[model samples]
Target: MNKELLEKGFIPDEICKVLPEGFQDIEEIASSLHKILANNQITNAVNEITQEKDLSKLTNSELERAMLLYSYVGHAYMWGKEEVEDTIPENIAVTWYEISEKLDRPPILSYASYALNNWALLDESKPLSLDNIRILQNFLSGVDEDWFIMIHVAIEYEAKNVLGSLKKYYLDEDFENKNLEDALTSIKKINEIMNRMPEKCDPYIYYNRVRPYIFGWKNNPATPKGVIYKGVEKYKDEPQLFRGETGAQSSIVPALDALLGITHSNDPLREYLDEMRIYMPSEHRGLLAGLDKFLEEGPKNKVVEHETFVNEIIGEVHKFRNKHLEYAKDYIFDQALKKQSNSNIVGTGGTPFMKYLDKHLKETVPKDD
Candidate 1:
């Protein structure tokens, strides 16, 4: 693929210049492409393994291993296609089915299900539907479902990376809050999946996948308009106004107004906007921009501000403790016939996996963009 991409002159010099610090060599890109191809080949090998209508040709153990291998291959191929913004050929799905037939296990069949159902939406260019969400929900509820994580990653990457322009397009057209909420929910589920992954996994892949969803979540109108700048001198041109009904000063309101202006494409040439509002010197713009920027950079710059870090940690801790207490008082004891310990829990209801999130908050301050 690298050779093809290089030959076709698709590798822009500027894009190559910013080739993500670790991916310095062209050969590494080639190797990654080969890995994707090799995975596809393994999926094809299932036909040979199952030939002559002979279930006796392969032992149960061999069939199980082959199915497991196919699952891994499908995941790798899916990730590769996403990274390059390319599509897998339709022939790949045939191979997926072939491999799935030989396998005795449910996991391989699950992958085959993903390949079939997902390809219809992804490769066949069908719109995302409530049915697709139901399928995803069921898959997540299934056992040994690594493909759920991969599928979650793919959806998130598409929503966050490519959907930003689409989101702005929707914003420009003034879509209703329900449409925006549905979009945000998709990304939110992606975040939940990413957060639930085991710590040993490479977080960069998860981060890259979920990064775009952040912007999608924020741009939605259903989000709360939190307090940003407080008691700071207001912009002379944008003075605080008193509401007729409440009689409270509209400091935060103005900040939100500015944000809507900046994000919703309300007169970009007016010089009042550049991604975020700035007249309010308080940490609102800084805080919001900080989170967005960090995620946008993926894992290249992992550090975060001290106050933000602390706040995030505190928030997660409170969330976990509350959920744990709720589950303990209401459900876990009945389901398992035993009390649960903190160590046995995971995610928002479990002990901290990323303690650095809170620690970084206390130790560092955010530098300006």
Candidate 2:
């Protein structure tokens, strides 16, 4: 029953950061998205590329790489205009949808395409810290945008140790308190990295530049009906609503919650968290669900006796969630009130977050004594 996670944690191994020669046309434009959008060339430049390239011919990693490029290109084209675009043009729409189908996720940008699979190492020999990392693609690149996503990337990198500890605690027969101890240590480290979010990613720059491009058509005042995929037949030319990329989609928190026996009330926030599950990679979803199921079926005596460890986990989660709520207010909610309408006050993930984040933080209590 000892199930081991991948060396890279929930992140994909050997992600295709760069597509191959056949995709040179798309790759070139994707690399310069920030510049292209500034010059107002995204629409015409994107429209010119045909969708003759075959996706089935691509490897899974390449398909992921394609998704990364197409997502950046799609978001840039849609949000880049001085005026908002209600319809995704045929060229971007058709190709992006195809890639989405292959990846089995929505056509719009998600966390995987945005941060999980969207990084490169400045020195592969070194560790995956911010010093060694560089974002592969960006809409309007800046310290704010780079730090926002890179902070996420850093947190994801740190979560591997958390997952490693959980794997041992769940599957290893001799699962020890050391596993829980290590998990809490990693959990604390995760919060530490998160607290540094404001260092370079200022609230104003994040709101005006980074946050704008990630908003999905769903629940958005700018594109309330969502975006119409002009040529994707499944929609029949209707507006399709998808949530924007949010940190909730990351597998790390869900895994930690499952490990610590944390549960949320059956409410809108819980429902929204489930909705974000669809956007996660299938294997990562299995990890969250399977870990929860494993706990329900496995003997509880081992973990129950360690009330002290459980309290430590709860406290760490509380710390992380509290910091998250603060970031939500400073980085998005307050900023939205100043610049955006009521609809956009929702989280970048396309859901009301203020009340939910607070509720989730309080719900991070210890298991019944």
Where does candidate 2 stray beyond 4 Å?
1-3, 6-8, 295-299, 340-344
| Residue 220 miss distance in model 2 (angstroms) | 1.3
Clashing pairs in 1: 160-212, 306-361
Question: Measured by C-alpha RMSD in angstroms, how accurate is candidate 2?
Answer: 2.0
lDDT of 1 at 248: 10
lDDT of each residue in 249-287, candidate 1, tens digit only? 112212222212212223321122232233211223343
* RMSD to truth, every model: 23.3, 2.0
Q: Top lDDT: which candidate number? A: 2
The local lDDT score (0 to 100) that residue 126 gets in candidate 1 is: 53
Residue-level error in angstroms, candidate 2, position 277: 1.1
TM for candidate 2 is 0.95
**TM-scores of the candidates in the order shown:** 0.22, 0.95
Count clashing residue pairs in model 2. Answer: 0
